[model samples]
Every structure is written in structure tokens, then in C-alpha cells.
Target: MKLVEITLDYPYNGGETFCKQELEIAEKYFDEILLISMSGHIGEGNIRYVPPNAKLINARKARYEASVYLKSFFQLLRIRTIREIVFAKKKLRTKESMPQILKEIFIYYYYANLLKRVFEKEVIEDDDILYSYWMAAPAYYLSIKGKKALKVSRTHRFDCFIEECYQPFRREIIEGLDCIISISEAGKKSIEARLIPFTSCLSEKIKVSRLGIMKKSSATDFGGKSNKYFTILTCSNIHIVKRLDLMIKALEKINIPVNWIHIGDGELGEQIRTQAKVLDSNKYVKYTFKGVLTQQQIYDFYERNHIDLFVNCSDSEGVPVSVMEAISFGIPVIARDVGGNSEIVSSENGILLDKNITPKVLMEAIRSILLLDDDKYINLRKNAVRKYRECFMASENYSNFFEMLISMAKEK
Candidate 1:
């Protein structure tokens, strides 16, 4: 059977990870695979960028520039490429800034033509299933209008709503599909909360699969003189949503001599550093701000470092990749019992903070996890590895997962 997976094809984002991991799994089962894309204006290769894979179609005359995003309201409204060229040329002749309208118009045509190519030219005419890796206008169009293949839409639910200005074409397109995959049960609830209000009935097309990471990640050494203090690895943005502050405050409250390394960069970077300096800059709560690294770097760090526990502070997630990576490495997790976090981590494998995910509670939980007897740590690690192998292998779970899609394709 023929199958194709399409994403905006941006590099190094969660959506990119989903696209790559799921595509790799699909490649093993399907005969034909097509991944189409145009250059997007995000961090080129930093945050989540990947070396080009599958099929790449960078349509820009040159690399994307900063001016592209500053389109005018009028241009944004009546966005058309023909009008954009005229607008840009007129602005240049007058030595004035191009209105935002021209830029918006350019992007509209950019995406439209890009999708036109993928739908009309690149995709195999008789593909059995056309999978949308991320929910967006392009995917919505293929799902709703493409007559050649069974359309499948997977909602990451990051912002799958019709906001004040941004139209949610993606949700509209997934209305009637062979499958509407949800990354987490929380994501499913978000769909029900946002979409169910308008409609009375929903379909079983909605299915949940926790995100996964490369199973065997290389470790990074925590480069310290001695491994005396318990090393905890906290991976997430240092933002209010991630609650890095809570982790820092909890460290202050705790009397134990522990050290934890932070594994991401975000708005809370400076604030968390200040908090750490104020609390105690000693080895007791050693906080390292390893800016966003490559996916392999992240794994290498985990492999080399003595990361005793994987702690998560985010308030929201589907099945977050950090937790999956931790489980895959047998590091276990200690996270707020919120969102799909509770679904991935269990009492047997890790400590689940009650609703009170405060500094005091977080401190106590860390102390407890670190203080676990030798047998307890071994058991937790053993059980977590077992869970990863049994329940979360990409090759196995996704085979059954895509098999369901194939079954649905037959019905359609």
C-alpha cells in the first residue's frame, strides 16, 4: 500500500519529532512514502531543527529574512502573492517600509502553492493513506478535499483552536477522517473541550499515543570534581508553565545535599539563575543551564551524566518526550500529577507529587527519591525499563497504531 506523511517540515520542534519518529515507523510498513515541505521562518536548526530528510522543497527565492513577518494589517487581510510583489516593489521605490499586508499575502500564496504541489504533484496518485503530521491549513485541505487517498489528521493540540486572529483550518479539516490521532489523553480532552461544544457527537477516530524518543541515548558527563551529591536531571523550559522556580524553591526548602542540572533554555533562564544565586550557589543545588542542544546531545548528556532521576515541571503536556526519554533510559520521573504526566509515570516507577506540587512538596519528593534504598532504586529502574520495552517501543506500538489506520483506510 502507498502512504505519505506531510509536515510543515520545520526543524527541531516537537511537531518535527512527531513527524520524524512516526514517519520512520511508517517507512518500515508502507511501500511509498512522501514528506513535503517549504522553508519556514523559525530557528533554522537550533531549537528542533533536523538535517533535511525525506523530501525538501525550499520555495523561497533566498533564505527567509526578518522583514517577512512584519506584514501590515491590510496585507494580512487581502493576502495574495501578486499583490505582495507589487507592495514590496512600491515600498522599495518610495524608500518606505513594506506594509504588513504584503508579507501576509506572500505567506498565504507560499503555503497555498506549497500544498498545491504536495497534493497535486508529489503525492502518489493511488496512495492508500495520506497522513498529516501536524494540524495546520495544509493538512486540513488534504483531509477535506484530497480525493486520492484516505486522509488522516493527528492533532498535537498545542493550539488547535480558532483564536481571535488565527483561523484553525486544521481542526475543520479533520472533521470526517479515517483517524484523528491524539498524542495524549489530555489532548483528547482538549479536543472534546474545544470541539465538542459545537457538535453533539464525536467519533472513535480519536486515539491516544504518548510521544517517544530515540530509545538508546548516549550519556553526557555532569563534569564535576566528584559525584558526591545526588544528580537530578530536570528537562524543560525555565518558564512559569514549566515551574523551574518551584524546583529551585523546593531545593531551598530541602535540607539534603543534592545537585540538579537543568537541560533547557527559556524565558525563565535568567530568573532561575538569580534564584539559584540567591538561594545558594554551592554544590548543594548546582543548577546548570544547558541551552537547547541537539537531540543526540540531550541523549549523550543523559548517558554520560549520573542523572539519578528525571524530573518534570511542566503544567501541561500530552505524553511529553522528556518523560519518554527518561523512562527509556530507566531514570524514572518525579513530576506534578497533572496533564498526561500522571499517565506516563506511576508510583511503582517514580514518585508522583500530589496536587500540591509546591516547593515544600517538591523538595520532599526529591529527598525521598534520592534517599530510596539501593533495592528500591534498582527496582524502580528495572520496572521503568520493562515498561519502556513492553509498552512504548516505537516499532511495535506504532505498527499496531498504523495497522489501525490501514484498517480504517479499508473502511473508507
Candidate 2:
């Protein structure tokens, strides 16, 4: 069977390097694959890791044709756009960016037209699987493409949450797809909860499939090597949702000498840095922002540095891969309790703060973790490692997932 995998951005960007490992595992199941980049960089400076028997198509380069848009516009309207508009007016309207909403809708229309041309020009086997990384716009477009191939989509944070969508998933689109795999159990529940009111039949098609990461050979011990000062780390795009400012404020509350390191940069990079300086005015904390680094560099940093505890203050997440990566290094986390975080963090491995995580709450969590004795700290480290092996092992999870996908694609 063949697989056509669509991603927003994967190998070409440093952010979603895990998709490369996913593609690597997927290569074993399918003879030939089509790797389509919905919005990945294709310039000379960018590097892409593609599978052996796969073709790469950077759809970002494709220009919009008026005829394609017109055809797709009508098709989209038929797929519950009118109903969605009504729902949007009544209630359950999305708070996401207007430009982002427009972009998502346009991308689906663009891709639907693009895929039609590709299918017409090429040979697509009946047993092939059309899988979109996210179950938002792409899945809907793929569903209406009128292809015999199996259509599957995986739901993540933004795509799965109705509150995050300007226009939530259409009932027809969910009914149309062969299967929908949510990255977290929480995400699956959210999808089913929304779909059940409209049509209970679509609920059966949604399934929970957790994300995984490659395990590491060696991991850092709990409490780090030097107990004199705590070294806290966070790896995420510095955005408002991430609430990095909270992490900085928490550090300020901790009188203990500490080292704070941030691995990624984003919209709030400068603002975060400015706030970090203001919060750490007493010099009790040493701040180091590594901007953005490749996954290997991040892992290497973990290997070289003595990181005490990983912290994630995000308002929402879909079982963050960064937390998994931290777990791979035997680092316990202190994360805000929201959107699949409880699946990863617990009292045994780490602390989970309430949704309304004030600086006091964060400070207390950090302080309590820091106060752990050797025996307790070691146990926490062991639990982190055990959790990774039990849930987030890449080889086992992805291999099993692909097998299931192939079986579904082959189903008559």
C-alpha cells in the first residue's frame, strides 16, 4: 500500500523534527510514499530528511488558480460550511486569529485543487492512504476529493479543540473520513464530545493514539550534579500561550540561586527576555536563552548540562513532545494541568499545577521538587524513565500505529 502524508511543516523546519522519525518508521510499511509539505521552507538553506522511496512536494510553491478556487469554494460550501456559519453565529465561535482561520480554509481549497490535478496526472492506487497530520482543514478537503483511497487524519491541540477553531470540524467531514486518530486521549474525548451531539455514528471512527519519541541511552539523574543551584530548562516556542513569563516570575520567587535556560524562540522572545531581566533583577537567577537549536543540539545540551527539572507553563498542550523529550533524559517536569498534561506528569514523576497557575503555585511546585531528598529524587528520576518506556517509545508506538493504518487502508 502507498501512503500520502501531509504535514504543515516537518523535516524542513527545526520545530517539528519528530516528524522525520515518524516518516522513518512509516517507510517500513509502505512500498512508496508521497511526502507533501503544506507550508515547509524549500529554499537552499533549509534541509529536509526524506525517506528512501518517497517523493517530496512542497505545496507552498503552488500558486492559486481562480478556477480551482471557484470549484473548491462550491465543494467546501456543500460540506457543511452553511451549517458551520450558522453554528458560528449561534455559539461555539473560535477565538483564534482571523488571518489564521482564513489561511486554514484557503489552504484546504488550494490543496484540494492541487491534489485533484496530481491524481489526474498520476496513478493513485485504490489501497493507498491519504493521511493528514492534523484533522482540521486538510482532512475535510481530502474527504471531499472523491478518491477511492482511504482517508485518515490525526487530531492534535489546535485542530482538535473546538474553542481553538474559528470554524469547528464539519459533521460531513468527520462522517466522510475513514478514521480519525487523536494524538492524546484528552483530544480524542474533545473530538467525540463535539461530534456526539451531531451524529453518534462518527464517534466510533475517532480513536486515541498517543505521540512518541526516540529513547535515549543515558539520562541525567534527578536534582542534577550540583545541588548548590538548581538548573531549570524549558523547550518551547516563546509564545503567550506558553506563559514563559510565569516561569520567570516563579524563578524570582525562589530565593535559591538558579540557572534558567530556554531552548526555543518565537513571537514573545524579546518580551520574555525583557521580562526575565526585570524579574531576575536581584541576580538570584542566571538566564540563558539559546534561541532555537536542532533536536540533536537540544539532546546534546541535556547530555552536557546538569538540568535539575524541566518546566512547562503552557496554558494548553496536546501531550507536549518537549516534556517527553525531557522524560527521555530522566528529567521530571512541573507542568500546568491542561490538555493531556496529566497523562504525562503525576505525583510520582513530577508535580502538576492547577489550571490557574499563579506565580505562587509555580514557585511552590519548584521549591517542593528542589527540597526532595536523595532517595525521593532518585525515585522521581526512575519514574520519569519508566514513564517514557511505558508510553512514549517511538519504535513501538509508531510501528504499531502504522500497522493499524495499513490494516485500515487495506480494509474492504
Candidate 3:
């Protein structure tokens, strides 16, 4: 049977590198794999290599026009929409205004209908697996239209947590899917807590499937550094949630020499750069912005250079793969304790700061690491590598993921 995977933008954009290892494992299990991208298109640059058995479909070509919006507006009158509105009013103590809720519902139906039309043309079979990379519109559509196929979706921070994004018809989506896979135990718990108002049995379908990375050929040497400056690396889309500005502010307060290297770029890139200019006056704080790099390129950077610390000050996460990559190379992390960050990072491998981490608090965490004796520092590096092997090793995680998929397909 075939396996159809739905993604936002994989094999086209720099984002979703986490799917690369999982796809490699998936290629071995499914006879035919269809990679349908909801937002990916050709000539966007940095197109990734797809597996031999998989076919890439650029669904973005089917642009949503005024007609789609009109259709969505009409869908607001449907019984399902009304039921969801009633359910939300009774169960959820949402902070969103009525207009905001209605707007989100319109957008939801618009995308769900769009995705339904996109998949309608596909050659799906009864025993095939319809997997959504995110528990968003693709999963919502699949849950409605997946006929005898096994409908499954993986939830990340933004898609899984209501606080992160507006999830329309959350209950119905959970009810429709055969299984919902979360990237972290924290995410699984969150989903269960949200669904408690509906029914406890829905929680049975949820599972904690941690994302993993392939082990590097060699771990970074703790003492092998050409430069004397303490190197700090942060890799993520320069978004408001990532809090790059806070990092810059924190580095500004530190007295010791530091070389901060940021990987990846986003809408806030220019803004963050302007904010970082303040650090230029401080000779002790030197920062570099390495624009968007492919996953291999990031790993190559790790191999060639010695990174003293990796820091993630993000407001939320679903066990960031960037942190996993850093720890794989024995780089100790200093991340805010949010979402799955606590599961991967701790006092052993690195410092897990509180969620309400300010610039001053972050600076103190950095100083704490800088103050560690040679033996203590070396132990932290060793622990970082050990953590990567035990929890984030790709071979064990992805193999088990596909085996579960294979079992579900067979059972169906």
C-alpha cells in the first residue's frame, strides 16, 4: 500500500528539516510515497533531495481565490460549524473575541476545503496511510475524507498547543483521527488536558513520539578551539517567539569576551540585526548572522568549528531539533524551560532556565557555565552527548515510528 505524507513546506524550503530523517526511514517501509506540500513551490531555492520512491506534488499552485473565501463564508452556516461554536462556548474559556473566533473559523474551513480538493485528485487506497506532518488543515481534511485509510497526524508546538495558535474545531479533529502523535510528552499531556472536557477516551489515541536526529560521525572535542572567545550558537527562524533580541541584550551585559553566531533568518532578521548593533560598542560581545543554511550545512559548521554553548530562548518549543543537533556534538545548551525543552535539556547536560527568562537571567546562566571548572565543564559536554544518544538518536526513534505505522496499516 501507499503512504501519503502532507507537509507545509518540505523538500522546497529551509524549514521542516526534522522530516528529513523520518522520510529516509519511511522510504524503506512504504511501496509508494507521495509527498504533498501545502505551501512548497519550485524555484524557491534550497530544494531538498527527495527519496527515489517518493513523488513531490506542489499544491501551492492551486491558489485560493475569492471563490474559495465565498465558499468558506457560506460554510459558516453549516451544522458542523454551529455545533463547534456551541461546543467552544460551553467548554473552552477562550480569550479570543467573537469576531476573532469567527475569522479563525472562516480561515480553518477555507484551508480544510482547499486541502480536501487537493487530495480528491490523488489515487488513495483502502490500506494506505494518510499522515499529516502537522495537526493543522491537512490532518483536519484527512480526518473528514480518509475513508478506510489510516488517518494519522503528528503535533508540534504551534499545532498542538492552543495557546500557541488558534485551533478551530479541535474536538472534531481529534475525534476523526485514528492516532495523534506528539513530538513530546508535554505536548501529549497538553492534548489530553484540552480533551478532558470532551471525553477521556480520546486521550487513548494520543502518543508521545519524540523527534530524533542522525548521530554525527564524530562528537566535538571539548578542548579543541582555535579561538579564545567563548562561542555561543543559536539556530532558528528569527521570529518574535525565538526572542533573539533578548539574547543580544543578555550578551551586552556580560563582561567576558563572547562570539555569538546565529543561524537561520526570518522576518525579524533585519530588526534583530539593528538591535544587535548595540552590542557592537561592547568589544567583549561580537555577533555574526549566518543566514538560512540547510541541515547538512549546519552540521558541517558544527564539524569544523568548536561551539562552547547552544542557547534557545524561545517562548515555546516541541523539543527543538536545533538543540538536539548541538547536544549531539557535545555542546551544552541553555534554554528556557518551555514545552519539551525541559525533557531534552537539564542541569546535567546544560542549564534549563525558567520560562520567564529575562536578559539579566540569561546573562547569569551564561556566566554560570563560563564559571564551571574544567572537570565540571567536561562532564557537562559528556552528558550532552550521552543525552543525544539516549533520547534523540534517529535510528531508534524513526524505526519505531514507521513500525507503528506499518502495524496500524496492517490492522486496518
On TM-score, the leading prediction is: 3
Q: Tens digit of lDDT per residue, candidate 1, span 119-195?
A: 56554654478777666545655655647568876766453422212323333454645567777677677666655
Q: Which stretches of candidate 3 lie over 4 Å from their true place?
A: 40-43, 224-227
Instruction: Give the runs in model 2 whose Cα sits over 4 Å from its true position.
Output: 60-80, 91-104, 200-202, 220-225
Candidate 2 steric clashes: 0
Q: In what order do the candidates fall by lDDT, top score first?
A: 3, 2, 1
Give the true-structure RMSD of model 3. Answer: 2.0
TM-score comparison, 1 vs 3, better candidate: 3
Better of 1 and 2 by lDDT: 2
lDDT of every predicted structure (CA atoms): 0.62, 0.78, 0.85
Estimated TM-score for each candidate: 0.77, 0.92, 0.94
Residue 307 in candidate 1, Cα distance off native in Å: 1.8
Clash pairs (backbone) in predicted model 2: none
Off by over 4 Å in 1: 11-15, 38-53, 58-114, 123-126, 146-148, 160-171, 217-227, 281-283, 354-356
In terms of lDDT, the poorest run of 10 residues in model 2 is: 216-225
Query: lDDT tens string, model 2, 62-172?
Result: 444677677766665554545555555455555655456555566666676666665576677789898988776667778777788888898888777777555445565
State each candidate's clash count: 20, 0, 0
